[model samples]
Target: MPWTPPLEADALTTLLSKVQQWTPFDGNALLDDVGAVLDDVVPPKEDLDVLAQRLRGHLMQLVNIAVTAEAGDKDPEADRLIRQAHTVRAEAMPDDHRRAVGHLRRLGWTVNELLERLVAANCLREAA
Candidate 1:
């Protein structure tokens, strides 16, 4: 399983509720073109904070769609993908900018895979 941040009881409960209530038209799914999310995390801004936030937000987007689609009954692979995003988020990044960018890029690919899966499942319209 992909490692996720430890969830508090309340947060877990809320996620469960949202999952239970999700529909194909659910607002919880991330329908944005998230492809450029890390475009800024290049040479000038690969600092710890910048990369961390981007990573978190990226994972959140992946997780949101996966969970929502799972609820919609359109995808059973959601759980594994969600876990993979969690794993990427929990890993430590190197202090070197190049290494950091590489780490973030790995997660970026994971995010792209989730987006692709969502599209295949008919949960998201492909952005032009």
Candidate 2:
């Protein structure tokens, strides 16, 4: 049997719930993507804050790279949303896991979408 580390209730709930919603990918493709992103990302019992920060940092960096690769000024509204998500992620909230997952949920749109909207929004902002 493969060893599975314990995960926080809320984080586990969020991950499983999101995975359950993905129907387009056959078999384990969706799970594979999720696994790829979360592989070895076990958070110590008292270090949820650090884990949340690291996850958000990855998302923020992807968003920055996507936004910066565009020509001309970015759209104010799309930029605002991405910035808002970034701001929400910067705080050290008590429900750090839930809040971080929630931000990902809102930002990504679907289980496999994963930052696509933020990138699209940034591109649209540049086009606007």
Candidate 3:
């Protein structure tokens, strides 16, 4: 079946073509902030909601960049990023603070990995 995107077809095509440059998404700062928060074995869950929201956005962008770069289907690393993005999207915010903390921490790790893979694929502005 042909699936429809939320965006209009022509608009989405143009936007995705530009996404190949992987700009407007700061992987360095994102890595730093996520690292700082997850540095502790158990980070406070108070900010999990905000962090998760940001991470979700970043993951989605990463997936789009991967697709634009022609990495999503054939490359193993991009495939991993796509799968992880799907996982996070399917997940819900954990009610228990501890679980929430754990989930965010894991997402932190995933984002870090995705950035590395993207850099290696020459998708980002600079090596991450």
Candidate 4:
């Protein structure tokens, strides 16, 4: 299914809750952290189009990282791809997005692992 933009605070909250529930951390703590972060974000008007786009970019970066990591050591091309991904992430993310990205980065998760987990969470959320 195509991604749907979050229109209300409740919707975003629900998404956050769903994502947090699927996270590896203690469910309560993850939910609390997600709530704290959501409290800071200014709700997007009409749609979460910008946030969605930023997330898509982030996902693509993770894909690049996964491919590079799987290929072994950092060659010139891998280095260039990683650099490009970092640049895109820096340019696309806002403060809350940065925090979310930072939290994930600190988790010591590989790109493929993150992608798989996120996709599974999103799928489950949609199913629910």
lDDT of 4 by residue, 1-128 (tens): 99897899999999898778552323234333333334445334422344334344444545444454552143454444444445544453334645545433322122223444433434212111
| TM-scores of the models, in the order given | 0.56, 0.37, 0.73, 0.26
For each candidate, the alpha-carbon lDDT, in order, equals 0.63, 0.47, 0.75, 0.42
Better model by lDDT: candidate 3 vs candidate 4: 3
Model 2: C-alpha RMSD to truth? 16.7
Clashes of 3: 0
Q: Superposing all C-alpha atoms, what RMSD in Å does each candidate have to the true structure? A: 9.4, 16.7, 7.0, 16.9
By lDDT, rank the candidates, best first: 3, 1, 2, 4
Candidate 1 structure quality by residue, lDDT tens digits, 87-125: 887888777777777776777677767667767777676
Please, what are the lDDT tens digits per residue for candidate 3 over residues 2-119?
9876578898888788778555877676876577557865655676788888877777777778888888676787897778877965588899998887778777777777777888
Best model per TM-score = 3
Screening candidate 1 with a backbone cut-off below 3 angstroms (N, C-alpha, C), the clashing residue pairs are 2-83
Model 4, runs deviating above 4 Å: 1-48, 51-72, 92-128
Highest lDDT against the true fold, candidate: 3
**Which consecutive 10 residues in model 1 have the weakest lDDT in total?**
25-34
User: Number of clashing residue pairs in every model?
Assistant: 1, 1, 0, 0
Question: Looking at candidate 2, what is the lDDT of residue 32?
Answer: 41
Model 2 stretches astray by more than 4 angstroms: 1-47, 71-77, 95-114, 118-128
